[model samples]
Target: MFRAIRLPRRTLLTTAAAGVVISSGLDREKLPIYPTPNPPILLVDSPSSLEQQIGVARRTVVGTYDNAYSKVQDVVSNWIGVEKAVENRIKSLHDPTEPLTPSLLYVGVATLSSTIFTRTRSLPTRFLLPPTFLVLSLNYFLPKTSTNISTYLTSLEETYLPSVAEKHAIGRAHTAMTWERIKDFTQESREKFGEGVRDAVKNVEGWTGLKLGETLRVQKSEAVEVVVGVTKKVEEKVEEAVAKSFVEEKTAVDKPKEVPVKRLV
Candidate 1:
């Protein structure tokens, strides 16, 4: 019967590191588009403005020193765990803890191991060499690989996230400003409309010579009739002047002008 061995969280993290390295080699344009982090409402306005806030949050959330230390710790711990797993896998091949049956497969493996032992003069090289080589190789390469992954991820965040965050923040601010402007305009319009209505009411009251709740009784004022008669008389005088000018022009045109005759001398 086989029992399951639960892998540590560090193992999972190391596996993820491998994935990240693989992904970094691929075309970045083909990567998924992700949205930026949004803080609570009204906290941010633009990217430049939010930089200070982000810094404060970073320091306060976990102290600067602590955060950095934890990162280094995680990297070291993960590498150690990964190297240990590699050692175990290698060790299992040569010296497995499980019982071995006398089957053809076992016989062949044993025969191969004995032959390798004879060929290699070094006793440690016969059994422990492969695991030691693997541990050393992983120790050297994993740090570099993981560091590259971290750098790529950091660059991605810097390139894409800040712009998105700024746009979102500015968009929100603009929306709020627009709403305020609209409300102010609406209020001003209502005030002006009310004033116009009041003025109209006053003008109507004065024109009709009536008060509020009064019947529609239009008084025939002789002043208006007199003004209209005066305007009509003025118009007639202007028309007569125009007609007289035209008549004088026609008479002047009909009158023959004496032409000077040049004598050929």
Candidate 2:
């Protein structure tokens, strides 16, 4: 019955890669085990799992510290790009007699703030500082000098302290902006993977005539258990192999070597 339902190959691969490949048609005991691919798909059964996967993803994408620093630079560059775009649009209006208004500056700032700050929250505070500096520079609120920026921020240190700023460098406005963007991104992602999950569940539901949600919950549990069991076995095998190799080496080193004695007679 499960074989009858066809899912998009890409979607199936995605679900499988997430370590949630649901298979109600086959017995759990009979499932064939195989080595997970290099850079194994994370089974995010809990919040900790999700956090672990996200950290791995950040390290992979950001690469070296220099690269991460460059990414922050790029964020500033993008803000400059927006500024250029806004300036060009204003010039296109071709009113030489008109002054370049704060209205244009406001538009540029809005675009910059939305795009720059809306980037994933996983980015480190240090990385955000570069773009934050650029925002202040472009807005003419502050000179983009490293020292001045540092000094100004230090003055605001009291705000960042436990007494005021909290652990993050965010303010009420930033909190609002970040949450808005996070909501939008989360909703979009949910609708995406949710469709795939729902479709898979529906296929099983058709076979068993069970409700979609209940079938999904069952499949999710089964998949998590299968993935965890497989992972544990793999880890155990690796540890055993390492221990055996160490023992063999130690024995080889400790064994007495037969040396031929030269008889003086």
Candidate 3:
């Protein structure tokens, strides 16, 4: 009798427990991976994979920069013929083929002209700052400045670097602007994108619109061709988040491998 009663009770307990689990609507096997409500597409533990992790990018900053680079190259290449023309006059009077010929001066002048074109390509246009800014920023926002000799090198940027304050000021301003531009990536994702970002981006778009951020793409609907023209010094962790930000329907910015820099002659 006792055995029969105990067996029935145990069976009942087991059934009740199973029912409770289902009633609670809990899936023991599944748990949310991202803490943030709007997380990036891919999460990389290592920095090397950041570039590889770039998700289904709807747009890329490199495109605009790349176009700029190509345009500048064409301009410089055209000047090469001018240099040859200048040399032609000298070639007529002397053996221009000779290395020591006076035509060498013409060659030098042409070379210098091309160098200027390169310089123009290097500088930030109305659209953006050149890669030099990123190099400077990486040096500026050092995770540990005094850790190595590089620290001293970056420190020198503060002293010898031209327009340090100017660049930083522009950088900070651009950063403020970018936060807002990012918000527009996800419709109704405004809250998910964050707070200060919305205001900053809205203001930036109001001031610069799509014209400034015209790195990867351009649209007529946008007030300007570019968006917030920012060059941030993204750390390793941040890079991972950014890389995975793309989705099939939703879009995000594509980080470029090389940042542009413009220096004086």
lDDT of each model, Cα atoms only? 0.69, 0.71, 0.56
Could you estimate the TM-score for every candidate? 0.21, 0.28, 0.16
lDDT of 3 by residue, 1-265 (tens): 4564455778999999999999677766567787757656987676455555563242366777789999999999989988998677444434323344434354455545555556657444422433344334433443232134344444566778857856865896899888777766564576656555656666787887654334323453343423332223345557767666645225433544576788989
Point out where model 2 deviates above 4 Å.
1-214
Which portions of model 1 show Cα errors greater than 4 Å? Answer: 1-160, 213-265
Which one wins by lDDT: 1 or 3? 1
RMSD of 1: 53.7
Worst ten-residue run, lDDT, model 2? 138-147
Error of 1 at 216 (Å): 16
Instruction: For residues 133-247, write the lDDT of model 2, one tens digit per residue.
Output: 5565544532233344454465577655655544444575688899999999999999989898888878878898879787558899999999999999999999999999999
TM-score of 1: 0.21
Give the winner by TM-score.
2
**Global lDDT for candidate 3?**
0.56
**Residue 18 of model 1, lDDT score:** 94
* lDDT at position 231, candidate 3: 25
Give the worst 10-residue stretch by lDDT in candidate 1: 212-221
Clashing pairs in 1: none
